[model samples]
Target: MSHSVAEHEPAEVTESGNANGAGIDLKWLSDRVEYGLYQDCVHCGLCTASCPTYVMTGDENDSPRGRIYLMRAVVDGRASVTEKVRHHLGLCLDCRACETACPSGVQYGKLIEPFKVALEISADGDDRPPLLLRILLRHLFPYANRMKWALIPARIGMKTGLIPIARSLGLTKLLPKTLQRMEEMLPPSMPLLPPAPLPEKLEPVGKKRATVALFTGCVTDAMTPETNSATARILQHNGCEVHVVAGQACCGAVSYHSGDENGAKAFMRANLNAFDLSKYDAVIINAAGCGAMLKDYAHLMHHDPEAARAAAFTAKVKDITEFLVELGPVKPANRVEAKLTYHDACHLCHGQQIRNQPRQLLGMIEGLSIVPLEETEICCGAAGTYNLSQPEMSRRLGRRKAEYIDATGASVVAVANIGCQMQIRYYLDERGGSHEVVHPVELLDRAYGPLPGGTA
Candidate 1:
């Protein structure tokens, strides 16, 4: 839990054992920071082709390869954590699409996380929000009970017409646009029911073929419980016993992305204690952000001896699409008839290196034609709180994303993350068009039968 500045070392390039044929040799001090990871880069610019920020800003500094160069410079003591460096680094979506395209298989996400941590330590001024905002974001948002208490007031204000009145009076425009979007994106107040705790193990409904544990993430539980219920139903119908653990909280992705290492670690430990990993064939994370985080537990717990055991447990964690794909074909029901477009959540596609599973799963559903959206791999600018913190850029990205979705002429936009869903929903609403932004599981759920609380 103790964070300290990294010790400075003499300027010298360190070489990795495999760097002889791998290209560049990393320096010794750089090795401790895993600067060797960048040595594998051939600078072929393949990463630039897939980089969302690069596509958006057309700036080399905003590209993945460019950021790696900046990181390499810092590692070699050739660069300082200056404002320009920090700005370029901060602009990265950390979407990890670059890794998918890199033939060298550079570990971009892992490399960037440490670089961010080091940057935060080296930076001069505090980049974090006000004290109260920081406390609320770090503590309350990640905790279920506290989040419910906070949502209550927001929900009450929205239901009482205060939010609409304020907007009409031009009061909300005075507030930050991110706050305005948050107000507009609020779904109708739904009942906040506790997650259903499943038995340690479950026998598959029909053939008892596979057993899976579902990690119904924090926001999904409170904001979109239908996704969780639908996931459970779909899995169960497909001869899988679904175990839903109640104690699982946020995947710590939000805090980790914001440089709140302590908050992230605490949530990581709590999640580790919440489930028994060996019991299920695979840990199913429906939310793309949480899915990506679960897969990286080993790297996150690399420094903690006590949490290492739990980290190993996380090695088996799988996104729902990945898990379902591994289970082979499910008997297709001829119920899904809607034409839809699939928006790849950055975490699922790039972060976790899962690109085909969702598409494959969608293909299995009968009567559903998958129309490809333009720039499907680009970030929707909902990188955790990136939309809230950098509203202008977020809005720009969201509008671009909306245009792509609109071009497809699809009635439904299916995505895997709650944040992306909310952001996309906001853009669609602003355009004065009618299109439902839904989770892929919700679409699948509709294929199986009517959802628990009726179809939306």
Candidate 2:
């Protein structure tokens, strides 16, 4: 392993990484990370109640303040980066809820993200995630077409009931542990077909209000195609000329969060060159994770030579709901009569500070009642790939979220991210609850009228 805590004794470490010149690349821990970030935490417990992991475990080390302290200690050479420390940090959802909860305005993402990247750089053969899952995460997920092709077999198995039959026969247990966890998280009855891709162009129904490029990132595109189609239709209904730009790849969130920074950068660069900012008023994204990642392009590429372009690209990025609200969305004339509650995707509400825009849009549908969900801001254990990596905690939080949604007495639940929708639906199904978890845009699309290829 590149980083072994046992080899280094306690010593005064400086902002300049690896002052003692150990075998580790301590520069990973220091470079691009401001030393002052650790100072922003006032040790206040205000964020704990809001932290999903802390609320679930009641472990101080699982809390943001505690994790910050751990990373700082390891960097300062006052403490070692033991396996326990790694576990504590790995458990983080990176939902950025702490940023919203912190009064002193701590940039927790800046600190935690770098530290996780450093761990990836330092980890050895034995320290990495499962080999099979790692390959899928690295080689498959960031590529949309590859993911769609890869899921074809699984979709067939699902349609034929072979997947459930295998589970019943205990055949799936012979598979890799990571795959087993993923299967457990699948919706009770997985869909047979992916959503149809959006056309390159969709003209406004009445008069043009805005022109936007829709971002259909990898996982969301492969897993929830209908949501993407709905988002495009909704944008069109709102008097916006929508373009599904060519050459746009995954938003790099999967790679970045998986600790492949350079790979993430490549995806980001591809997206940067894909969209002509001059042609579009704003780059719209339905998935909250992809939206946050797209909007943070400036921060991610700050050190790159093309920083200006990244910032320019980021400046025009907006969540679909945010763009609609700012554009003064036209109210849908058709009624979508249903009682549902909105479960705030952590990235949309906390990461991007987009709390009200979704509900505001949902409120516009006639005869639609938007009920309040308890602990709506809490992460639903679908923090990117957390459910696969940390199955136990993920299940606990997923079940917790399902319970809260069940208590809402609503038949449908709206979520901004595909991950949340999948997790919630799985848990709801596991509990034998008949709840339809859907993207808010899907409902809006219904309100507007029939979809492009499907009936209302």
Candidate 3:
């Protein structure tokens, strides 16, 4: 791709992007992104194969190196933030697979993350996110209680079999596109029963090996409450005391990624205040996205007054699998009795470099045989809300994932992230597959014993 911006309009926007200072000043990118980070990319094309968007479109503009070049062009006054330029950047999954593929140790997430935020902030009215999506991201997703209450009607419909009937009759078409996608992603099973409320504290089942706090993520806890319950139990089963802070909130990824930089920082600060890092051996997060965001707190707040505290907090943040493996998991004795393939959540595998841990944890279970999945590390096109925003690319990638899952011939598909689980399950359902999509811990929990309400 040419580094020169597409010639449509002159680069008229100043540093403030507008007279009243609404959009980002392209010239000031050095203030937002460390100049060295962009220089780290050698444009080697090695990351192309790993980038989902480039793999799909074969457009260099969608690749990390190309995007880096685009950013450089815009920053150096050689290019304008044209609509076409924005579209290419918007299409990126931000899966950070390129970071895994890059030999130069470039922090791709750091570059793309803040750059996207700046790009969104500068977006003209025509290019801004739709109003409905803005409300959902700003209001609904960050609040656990609000999301739980909001899903009640859908839960009722699912319970009464009305949802399926509505879906079959095309009645769901009346809902907003985002809502329609949510409905489609909802598991086919009737009304999602709320999981048992985890106590603020749970003592270790055998002996107190460590004390840790659990991060009950906003949407993850509200949507799949059982995952959180199971996570707590598994921690307890392995001799760790778990604590849940009542005041804990979202990990701020939704807002941050959506270009609400202040909103993301606010959420991060709330979490920073909510957890006392000194008291716990680690702060455990079950969702991969949440874990990735929690782990980024120190970097996100590097220059803020809470820098010291945020650094302290981030050091203790660990994905449940990462924590368990480091603590030396107690071997699970019971049999799960299933053939399974694991799809690595991009953040868990690429962002956190946690490839072997979840698989190792699963390997400990009896009667569970793991199968290799083709392109298992590829994104399922559910990088948070990408499925709703970029439906075309999302659909293509989701279908691709479903095809791979089908080829596995496994009865179960184990995933670490809720987004991956929901996206894969929805696509698999579309392909008429009945495979079970579950968190790795859910399998471990089953091996330990039936969950709180007893398994189906």
Off by over 4 Å in 3: 1-23, 190-193, 450-456
Whose TM-score is greatest here? 3
List the candidates' TM-scores in order. 0.86, 0.92, 0.93
Please write out the lDDT profile of model 3 over residues 144-172, one tens digit for every residue.
88888888888888989999999999999
What lDDT does each candidate get?
A: 0.73, 0.84, 0.85
Clashes of each: 4, 0, 1
lDDT of 3: 0.85
Residues 1-456 of candidate 2 have per-residue lDDT tens digits of 111223321122223234343323568667768889998886766787888898888777788877887778776665666667778888999989999998889999888887887887777776788888789889998888997887887888888999989998999999888888777656555477765677898887777888899998888888778888889888888888899999999999888877799999999999999999999999999999889889889998888997999999999999999999999988887998788999999999998999999999999999888899999999999999888888889999999999999999999999999999999999998888998889999999889886445322
Q: Which stretches of candidate 2 lie above 4 Å from their native place?
A: 1-24, 187-196, 451-456
Name the lDDT of candidate 2: 0.84
* Sliding window of 10 residues with minimal summed lDDT for model 3: 7-16
How do all the candidates rank in terms of lDDT, highest first? 3, 2, 1
Superior candidate under lDDT, 1 versus 3: 3
